[model samples]
Target: MEKELETTVCEERIFESLYRKLSKSIHDFLYYKYGSNCNPNDTTQEAFLKLWKNCDTVSPAKAKSFLFTVANNMVLNHLKHEKVKLNYQKATTKTHTNVSPEFIMQEAEFLEKYNAVLANMKEEYRVAFLLSKAENKKHKEIAELLDVTVKVVEYRVHKAFTILKEQLEGFSIK
Candidate 1:
């Protein structure tokens, strides 16, 4: 029991020494990589915690490199996850404007004509068309956000406009 206690004390001393020597550099590197979103202090604290957890595998000489790699990867993964969540929110928002009854009636009439036109379209073309026209997204931006090709976006938009123009030829402007 006494020998085990001494070994634990020695390990703690090694961790403390390594942290004092390398914490500042690790924090600076993370700050440069992640900018404002990654707090230096938080990353430094997390590094020390991780170092403590994996102390057996990390020697004092290599501790800073290990911490920097882990911190950088964590920040990148966080950013990627946030982008996906934001895109989902934007895609689900209602695109049509809402106002009083007069505007509502006009919108309903347009929707009826729009639906009839859309009903004949292939699913992919219909989705691209509605997302572009209703949401006002640019072709390239829509392509990137939807993971489709820009050419596909262009084709769908053109097809949808052709169908709408044909369907609404006799409809009066409200």
Candidate 2:
């Protein structure tokens, strides 16, 4: 077992050397391909950790490609997990005000119409609308988060309103 332990330690050292050499370039490449929000630091760390854990399985020639593939998959998984979390948060965070039954009825009707209009919107438009209405995010903030122009956020908000107004027709909260 002592010889096996030594071999493992040697393998770990070699993996660390490779990781130190290739990490920056891989991170730069991923950042260029996927953009800045996806956190190159975390991705590179995860990729190398995977590589170190699986060192015996990875050949020297294919190691870099394996790292890139692992990083890319990590980024994709991160994006998907974020989407699921956002959707879950959006669903659960809605707060209903306690008011008169008549007022609550009106609010309910308006909510149904609002949801229907939102369903009709494109993902970008819907995202903007949710940020504006639910999160109360300003156009500048939404623009930064979505990586779009503030004017685009404004345009989407207006378009969302137009759609909602047309869909709701006589339904008024006030």
Angstrom error at residue 169, model 1: 36
Candidate 1 lDDT score at position 122: 79
TM-score of every model versus the real structure: 0.46, 0.46
Scored against the true structure, residue 82 in model 1 reaches a CA lDDT of 92
**What is the overall TM-score of model 1 with all chains considered together?**
0.46
Q: Please list all clashing residue pairs in model 1, or write none if there are none.
A: none
Q: What's the distance in Å from true for residue 158, model 1?
A: 54
Tens-digit lDDT string for candidate 2 (100-150): 889889879877877878887888888998899889889999999999999
lDDT to native, each model = 0.76, 0.82
Query: lDDT, candidate 2, residue 133?
Result: 81
What shift in Å separates residue 79 of candidate 2 from its native position after superposition? 0.5
In candidate 1, what are the lDDT values of residues 1-174, reduced to their tens digit?
A: 565334431287777777787788878887787776867778678867877888777755667688888777777777898999999878866756657889789878888877877887777778888788778889999899789899989998887777677777554322
Worst 10-residue lDDT window for candidate 2 reads 1-10
- Per-prediction count of colliding residue pairs? 0, 0
